[model samples]
Target: MRVTLSLFLAAGLAAIAQPTLAETLSFTLDNQTPNMIVQFHATPADGGTRTELLKKKGLYGGQSRKLTIADGSDACVYKIRAVFEDDSFYDVRDEIDFCENDTYTLAD
Candidate 1:
């Protein structure tokens, strides 16, 4: 009975030590405009803080990129904003259900 108790405790400890899976949102970004996208912001639809999508890189014209956001928030909808190299802003919409959409395209 002692050996069985020890094994059960060990199994319980091992399960407790396992890390939880991180939640993340992923989508593809398509740049169809003639300008280069210098900045990308993904803000929650609930008026919370915003997240920067670009990882120190620019999305050139006609380029496609896969973006992942793991802001530790339970927000499924976000307001998308993209800034071009020409200092122009591109707002995709008021708010988008990023969890439902897999691809977001920016066009002229």
Candidate 2:
């Protein structure tokens, strides 16, 4: 009986130690504008300081980068902003459902 109880306890502990699965949002950025440098930013749609997903060195035309955002759930949305070499910018506001989209492209 002691051995059986020990086995049960060990099984319970193992289950407790297992980590829960969290949904994550992942996507690729594609640069389609030729001869321009591009930088990317991401922020929570509800409102927060922007986080630079890409910085300093920029993505050139025809280049693509893969990014992953963890702890993303259906309840949350994100805003993505793209800055160009000429100081011009374009923003994709809170309209993005990250879980449903896999790629973002920057173009002229």
Candidate 3:
């Protein structure tokens, strides 16, 4: 009985120690506006610092860039920000679902 209890306790501790794996989401970003998209950022929908996706590159008008992001949690939701070369920024306002959505477009 003691051996069985120890086995059960070990199993319970192992289960508790397991960490939640992050989910990866990939989608296409389309630029329809006339200005060039200079910077792009994504962050947890709840509240977190934005991480740049462009890697010091820029997306021009009529161009599309594929982006891949790992969700910190299972929600798969993120806040997207796009800055243009014309000194303007676009805020998605926290409604983007990177998991379910196939594409995000920036327009005038």
Candidate 4:
């Protein structure tokens, strides 16, 4: 009887200790501009200055990268910025719905 009780308790504890899975928003970036390096950033759409995701490692022309936005809430829109090697940049402020699209292409 004691052995059975201990086994039941252990099984209960193990079930309680199981961790929950977290939801994540992810996307892919494709650099189509020839001869230009690319860097990108993802920020909240609420006009705050906090950068939720940044890729400073640089992506060469024709390269692609996958990025994850760590927002677990119901936020579906975000600000995106792409910086080129020539100091020129493109900004999309609060106009992207990341939940519906998973791929972004950077071109001239």
Candidate 5:
């Protein structure tokens, strides 16, 4: 009986130790000229590697955008860039933190 009680308490304590996560994080970019192209990439802060999210063409002073990445326990950094066919590019980046573990419920 004592061993079971101790195990139950330990599990409850462990559950309380987890952290919560934010709902969303997003960004937009401004392309320099008409019909300019851009690429969106994310680089995890853990020094893993950079992943390409998107590429598109834009109008003058046009916009490039991206949405949610995935439901994962790891925090990551993201970067966006405008790349031209001529090889000229401009980049913007930011980092977002995520919960490694958390108890959550869906919002209706």
Candidate 6:
């Protein structure tokens, strides 16, 4: 009985040590001109292979939308950018660190 109890406690501790899955990264852009297009990217080290995960037009005036970042990708910094229909652009290209179970949340 003692041996079985020890094994059960060890299994429980191992499960608790595991990290929880992180939430997806998100951002919002508001007041965009109608009919304009937006773009976002997840930048990483080695200066190679940037992913474009979202592309959509302005849905409403003074609105906010959340950006999505995929799970289980290469580890490195991340950033996002936007491009309007009229060739105008806005970029948020900051080297933000990301952990396997870390998440970022933006407001307004």
TM-score of 1: 0.76
The Cα local distance difference test for each model comes to 0.88, 0.74, 0.83, 0.73, 0.46, 0.54
Runs in model 5 deviating more than 4 A are 1-24, 33-35, 55-61, 64-67, 71-81, 91-108
* Candidate 2 structure quality by residue, lDDT tens digits, 1-108: 999999999999999998776556788988888845556777777776566776576888889888766633332368888888898888864467677788877777
Q: Check candidate 5 and list the clashing pairs.
A: none
lDDT of 1: 0.88
> What would the per-residue lDDT of candidate 4 be over residues 31-104, giving only the tens digit for each residue?
88884555577666765444435456778889888888775444667788877788888886447888899997
Clashing residue pairs in candidate 1, if any?
A: none
Candidate with best lDDT: 1
Per-prediction TM-score: 0.76, 0.63, 0.82, 0.64, 0.43, 0.44
On TM-score, the stronger of 4 and 5 is 4
Q: How high a TM-score does candidate 4 get?
A: 0.64
Residue 25 local lDDT, model 5: 39
| Runs with alpha carbons beyond 4 Å of true place in candidate 2 | 1-23, 70-76
List, residue by residue over 1-108, the lDDT tens digit for candidate 5. Answer: 999999999999998987766334344433435544544445556664565545353323444333344434255444334455556665544443422312111111
What's the C-alpha lDDT at position 104 in model 2?
77
Error of 4 at 14 (Å): 24
Flag the better candidate by TM-score, 1 or 2.
1
The regions of model 6 sitting more than 4 angstroms off are 1-24, 27-37, 57-61, 71-76, 97-108
Give lDDT tens digits, candidate 3, residues 1-108: 999999999999999999978777788989998888998888878776567888778999999999877545555778888988877898887579887898998887
Q: Model 6 over residues 19-96: C-alpha lDDT tens digits?
A: 876445544434444544455456654464566645554434345565556544545466645555566665654566
Q: Tens digit of lDDT per residue, candidate 1, span 1-108?
A: 999999999999999998766459999999999999998999888877788999769999999999988887778899989998888897876688878998988889
Model 2 superposed RMSD (Cα): 5.5
